[model samples]
Target: MAMARRLVLWGVLAACVAAGAGDWSPGTATFYGGADGSGTMDGACGYGNLYSAGYGVNNAALSQTLFNDGASCGQCYLIMCDTSKSTSCKPGNTITVTATNLCPANYALTNGGWCGPGRPHFDMSQPAWENIGIYQAGVIPVVYQRVQCSRSGGVRFSLAGSKYFLLVNIQNIGGSGSVGAAWVKGTKTGWIQMSRNWGANWQALSGLVGQALSFAVTSTGGQYVHFPDVVPAWWQFGQTFTSNLQFSY
Candidate 1:
């Protein structure tokens, strides 16, 4: 009797895991940005300007889980409209977008708050939404999946705030794509782990203004790279540095 009960529980657990691992999920999408071509500049993930030439205006804001509270920053996704639900959708058409911001929390007392109670959703830019569905639809059902980020040149790091605060933004990442973990070290101190501040930005609260900065990054796909002396000792706030290292897909 005991063995049978254990087996049943195991089977149930396996089924639940399988269901959660579905390749495609159903959700809703809405668009932001207008003729002025501006959306929220201070994305939860710390990206300051989404309309810049580097990031472009085509980006998205995802719900909390999808946003992973900033871990999903710089992540790429391929989203397609569900024609069965919205007839206006172009058959088999899809749009690729980079995760740049976080959708605001639903504050309603009922119906699970802002983004629909932790539901999978995308708050896309108007240009991105237009790629797969008619803008007139306003909201459309869709499916999306993570894909590797592709970019040219090396990875770049930008310093924000003061050197004592040590906020760094990692950009132009390539391969397994999104950053999962980052560590920083100065000339005198040992490796210091940095916390994700938002989007591609990470922060370490320490005083290392005069020491060079080196970094090690781990991607969401589990790959890792160590960049030594990526930032010179003279690095200062509001400055950007580039490293020749990147991850393999």
Candidate 2:
């Protein structure tokens, strides 16, 4: 009888341990490294992707886990630079980065393009995301996806007060009609026309030729023109349309 009682007790203990020792609660999933303007924005925005990111340190502890159950949040981001040099939240992005993290060391913050109010901004004026460090206690392996080429900022130029020739590479995603149009924001409302040299310098195609094409831009004196294909507006080339916006100058 004692042997059976002890066996039952052991079973009860095992069940209790199992109840309390479940897989560590998942924190906010984050994503880092790779081109920002690419489709990667979907993952960075926590839509869904191969990698994950974002979470505080030592999240497995039983106490701090009560702060948030992550019932409705699955967002994440950031990564270590070189595993030795810890200073500043060196993001893995390679384009125009506007750091919005109020606290740069603990974790990452949401991205609110252009510095506004207390939004953080990492000056892209020099080498970045180098010499990152990690700890053994709170430091755990997060997800980092290395998808897509960093081609967004490979050739972004602005003409503040002059007319310039720009060469646009046009490529149809699939169909054979309306290759789409390129627009430029001239420091005002509505997008202006982006021209192309048909045979000399630049050339732009109509909506009936290909899905992708380049256009020239001209800014009057004291006027600033920002290309529409700069950010957030990707060459929609997915379904019957896709854009291979390679370069423009």
Per-prediction TM-score to the true structure, in the order listed: 0.82, 0.21
Best by TM-score: 1
- Estimate the TM-score for candidate 1: 0.82
Best model per lDDT:
1
C-alpha local distance difference test of each model: 0.74, 0.24
Model 1 clash pairs?
45-198, 45-199, 106-113, 106-114
Task: Compose the digit string of candidate 2's lDDT tens values, residues 1-249.
Answer: 445434543454345347662222221122233223223222111212211111112011111121122111111122223112222222232121222112222343234322223322221112222222122212222212111122222223212111233233222111110122345342222434655332111232223122222232332111222234332322332212123333221
Per candidate, the number of residue pairs that clash is 4, 28
